[model samples]
Target: MNALRAACLALALVFCCTPPAWGEGFALNEWSARGVALANGLVGRADDVSTLAYNAAGITRLPGTHVMGGLAFIAPSGSVETRRADGTRSTAAKPNTWTAPHAYISHQLNDTVWLGMGVFSRFGLGNSYSGNWPGRYNMYDVGVQTISFVPTLALKLNEMFSVSAGLDIMHGHMYLGTKIPTVAAGTFRRFDNDMQLEGDGWGVGAHLGLHMRLNEQWSVGLSYKSQVTMHLTGDVKFDWHGDNLARRQAHLPEARDCDAEATLQLPDSLALGVAFKPLDNLSFEAGATWTRWSTYNALNIYMKDYDAISNKEWRDGWNFNASVEYRPLDWWALRAGFFYETPVVNEDYADFIVPTNGRKTLSLGMGFTWNNWALDLAYAHVWVNSTDYGSTGASGIRNIGITGGRSKNVSADICMFSLSYAF
Candidate 1:
C-alpha cells in the first residue's frame, strides 16, 4: 500500500471505528435482511442462490445462472435523563426514528468468479428530545445520521473454497440540535433553547471474507469490514424556539459558520459462521460477530467559530451476537438468534439523546425460493435488560446538577423485508 492508502487507513481507524451514538455496545448490524434474520448465519457458507450478501464467498456458489439484489427498512430509538441535587427527576422524550432504505446486487461470472455491489447505511441513527423536556435546562438536544456504498468481488478457488472482499465508499451527514445552558443573577431562566448545527464529509475504506467446505455436511467462514471517515460541512445556526421567533432569536450565538466538521467513531467488525446438515433434509447453521469500539473514548466536537466539548466513554464496550437456522426443504428456510452487548458509556457520559447501554436481542426470519425469484422477511425484538448508574464523572455535564435526573432505560425493536431475484 502507498502513503495515501496508509494515511487513509489510519484515519479510518481513528474516525470510522467510533460506534454509533446509540446501540448495544455500538455494533453495526446493517449487513443484510437475510443476515438480520438468520442473525448472520452465512459466515463461511453459501445458499447456492440469492442472499449472498451475508457471505461474499457464497456468491461464488451461485448454482448455475447469477445475479442478486434486494432492500430493507430500519428504525432506531433512544432517550436520556437527569437527576437534580434536590432528589428531583427529569427525563427527555426519546425520538421516534425513521431511516432511509437500502439495497444490494451481486453476480456470478462463472464457476470460480463472482462480483457484487451494495448501497446501504452502515450507520444512520438520530436521537431527538422534546423542547420543553424536563432536563431542558441541564440537557436539551442531540441528533446524527450516516450512510455508505460498498462494492465487492469473490473468487471460487475450487469445489470446496472461495473468498470475497469489499470497498466501503462512505458518505455521511451529522446534525446537532442542543441547548447550551448558562445562568446569571442567581436565576436560571437564561437556560433557553439553542439551535441545530449540520455538517458533512467523505471517506474510503475496505473489507475481506474467506470460506471453506470441510465436508458435505460441514462448512465455516470468516469476514471483516474496514471502517471509513467522512469530512462534513454545513451552516451553523441558533434558532430560538422561544415564543417570539425574532425578539427571542438574536440572543443566540452568532457564528461565522465557514468551514467546520463533526468527527464520528465508525467501528469495524469481524464475524464467524458455520453451517451443517445433521439430518438428510435438515440444514442447520450458526454465527458469531464482534465490533471494534475502543476507538471511541470520547465525543469531541470542533466548531469553526466556537469552543469544542470533550465527552468521555463514547467508545467503551463489546457486542456479542449468535444465531441459528434450519432449512427443511429446498424451497424454505427458518431462523432465530440472540445478542448481548456491553455498555458503551459509563454513568457519567450517559444522556437522554443517547440512552444506549448493554442490551439483549431476539430475532426470527425465513425465506422462500422459487427458481429465479424469492422473497425473504425477518422480525427482531431487542430488550436491553435495564440498568442504573451512579455519578462516575465520565460525563462532562449530567453530574453536579442542582435539580435533575440520574437514571436511564434503553430498548429497541427491528423489523425488515426483502424481495430478490437471480438469473
Candidate 2:
C-alpha cells in the first residue's frame, strides 16, 4: 500500500510539469505513419496492427501476432499580437514544439476472434507567453495532456462481416498561469498571480465498429467512440507576488493551497468510410468524421478557496479525407493524401492560449517490407487560415470592460515514423 501511494504521488508530479503539442481545437489525428499518410482513412482499409485504433474489426485481417511502434513530431509556429484599448500592440513569441509516441500489440486467437491493446496520446497542448504582454490577465501560460490505454476484442462472424469493441481508460493533466490587476490608492497596476493545479483521474469510454465487405472490389466501415467525463481531484497553489503596497492594497495573502476539482467532457466522434481497389497493386479510400465538440463549452475549475471558469464556446466540426496507394514493386509502396478540417472556434471565442482555426493538409509517405518486418515514414504540412480577434473575445470573466485581442496566423508541420513486425 505504501509503495502504491508513492507511485501515485510521483505520477501526479510528472503530470503537472510535462508539455505536449496538440493540433487545432485540441485534436490529434496522427496515430501511425501509415494512418497519417492516408489522412486517417484506415477505417475501411486497415492492413496492419494499427487498425486496432481506427477500426478494431479490421484486426480479423491480421493472420498472426503483430506489434507496432511509432513516433510523431509536431512543429508549430504562430504569432499573436495583442491590441490594447490605447492602440498599442504586443506580439507573443511562438510556443514550444511537441513530440508524441505510440505502441500497439495484437494477437489472433483463432479464425473468429482477435485481441489487442494500445497505449497512446489522444490530446495535448502547450502555450507560454512572455511577461508585460497586454493579454497577461487572460493567460501567460497553459498546458494540458491526455493519455489513453485501450483493450479490444474483435469477432469475425462470417466471411463478409466483422465487429469489435474496445474500452478506453484515459488519464489527464492540466496547468494554468496568469497575471491579475492590483488596485493601490485608486490606481490600477499589474501584479503577478501564479496558480498551479496537479491531479489525475480515470475516465471510461468505449469504441464500436462495423466492417462490411460489399464485394471483392468494394468495402465500407462505420465506427463510433463514446464521450467520456472525467472527474479530476487535486491540489491548487495560488501565489501573489508584487510590491508590499500592491499586495497590501489588493488584500491578498502571499500564498495559499486549496483542494481542487474539475470535470472535463471529451467529445464523441463518428466516422464512415469506403474503400475501392481498381487494380491488383492500387487502392483508394475516402472518409469523413463528425465530432460533437459543442459538448466542450467550458472548463469549470472548483477550489476550496476559489472558483473559476474558462469558456470555450466551441462548435461541432467535420473532417474530410481522401487517399490513394500504389505498389510498383513487391517490397515497396507509395502513398499520398489530402484532408480538410472545419473551424471549431470563432473570432469571438478565440484566445492567445487556444488559438483555433480552420486548416487543410497535404501528406506523402512510403513503406518498405522485408520478410515480417515493415517500416513506414510520412510527412504532413498544415495550412491555417488567418483570423482577427477584437471586442468579441472569451477571455474576460462574467462581464468586464477589460478586453485585449489581436490578429493571428498559425501553421504546423508533422513527421511520423513507424516500425511493425509480424510473427
Candidate 3:
C-alpha cells in the first residue's frame, strides 16, 4: 500500500511539472520505453506491466505484482516559409524540449482475475514561433497538455481468452497566443495588440481490451478507447501595443479582458495486433491503430459579448507498425521497430499550430533483466513530410489573415528510459 501511494504521488508531481511535446497529431505513444523501442507494437505481446496502457487484458499472463516507470524526452524542429509578391521569408519555430512521464502497476488476484493501474499522457502538443513572424496573426504560440489515470480489471474467460475494462479520468490544460491587427488613422498595421488565452479542465471516458492466445506460437490483441470531452473556463487578456494616439485612432475597439469558455472533443481510437514467436529467443509483432479524428470538427471559444470559432474538419488517421525482438542471452534483449502515421489535418484547413503532415519513425533499443529488476532504453527519429499551406485561402479561423506558407524540414527526436520490478 505504501509503495502504491508513493508511486502515485511521484507520477502526479512529474505530470504537473512537465509538459509533453507533439506526436502524431498530438497523440502520444511513448507510455513505456519498450513500447517506444517497438513502435508501440506491444498490443499483442503485452508481457510487461506497461500493458496497462496498451491492453490491460494481457496482465492476466503475469502471476505476481509488477511495477514500471519511465520518461520520454522529445525535441522537435521545423520552419515555415512564406512566398508573396513582395518577396520570400522564412521563420523557424523556437527551440524547445519537452518530457512525458508514465507509471503502471499490475497485480494478479486468484486464478482468473487481475488488477492494474496506469498514469500516462494520451494527447499533448507544444509549438512556438517568433512573435513577429508572417503567421503571427494565425498563431504565435500554442500548447495543450493532458494526463490520464486508468484503473482496470481483467478477467480470464478461459485458457485461451482474456478481456479487460477500465475507466479513463483525464486532466487537460491549454494556452494560445496570437497577434491582433488594428487600422490606425486610415493606415493598416500588421499588429497592434496581443491576445492570450489560458485554461484547464477535466474529463472522463472508458476503454476495453481483449487478448487471445490462438496457439502456442500465435496470439492476437485488440484495444479500444472512447472519446472524451473537456469544458475549459479561463481568462482572455489583450495587451495594446500602440501608443495612446494610435489606440484612439484605431478602427477596432479596445477590448477588455474577460472570462471565456471552450469545449474540446478528443478523439477515440481502436488498435489491433498480432504476435508470432518462431523461436525461444526471437519474436515478431505487427499492429495498426485507427483514430476517429473527425470528432474534432471545430474550435469555439465564447466570452462576454464575443465569440471565436475555427473550423478544423480533420479526418480520421491511421498508424501501422512492425517490430522484432531478439534475445541473444537470457538476460538481454535487442529490439527494433518502425511505424508510419497517416495525415489527419486537411490541407484546406492547415494552420501554424500543427505544422506537419504524414510522418514516419524508426527506433531501436535494448533491455536488460537481472533477477527481479529490468531496465529499458530506446531512441527514435521522426520524419515529417513537407506540407504546403496558404493555397486554400481558408485560414481555419475566422477573421485571421491568410499567410501563404510552406512548412518544411519538420522532424523530431525521442529518447526513452524506464525501470521495472517484479515480485
The candidate maximizing TM-score is: 3
Q: For every model shown, what is its TM-score relative to the native structure? A: 0.80, 0.87, 0.89
Q: Report clash pairs, candidate 2.
A: none
Q: How much lDDT does each candidate structure score?
A: 0.57, 0.73, 0.79
What is residue 362's positional error in candidate 2, in angstroms?
A: 1.0
Highest lDDT: give the candidate number.
3
- Residue-level lDDT of model 1, residues 206-225, one tens digit each, is 86878888888898878777
Whole-model lDDT, model 3:
0.79
Ranking by TM-score: 3, 2, 1
**TM-score of candidate 2 versus the correct structure, residues matched by position:** 0.87
The parts of candidate 2 lying over 4 Å away from their true place are 1-24, 88-90, 183-190, 238-255, 305-311, 391-393, 396-404
Query: Could you give candidate 2's per-residue lDDT for residues 18-59 as a string of tens digits?
Result: 322535467777889998999987998866888877887888
TM-score, cand. 1 = 0.80
For model 1, the stretches where C-alpha displacement exceeds 4 angstroms are 1-22, 46-53, 63-80, 90-97, 137-142, 182-191, 240-259, 299-301, 305-317, 387-389, 392-396, 399-409
Tell me the tens digit of each residue's lDDT in model 3 across 248-320. 4454544445566667777899999999999989999999999998887776655544455656677898999
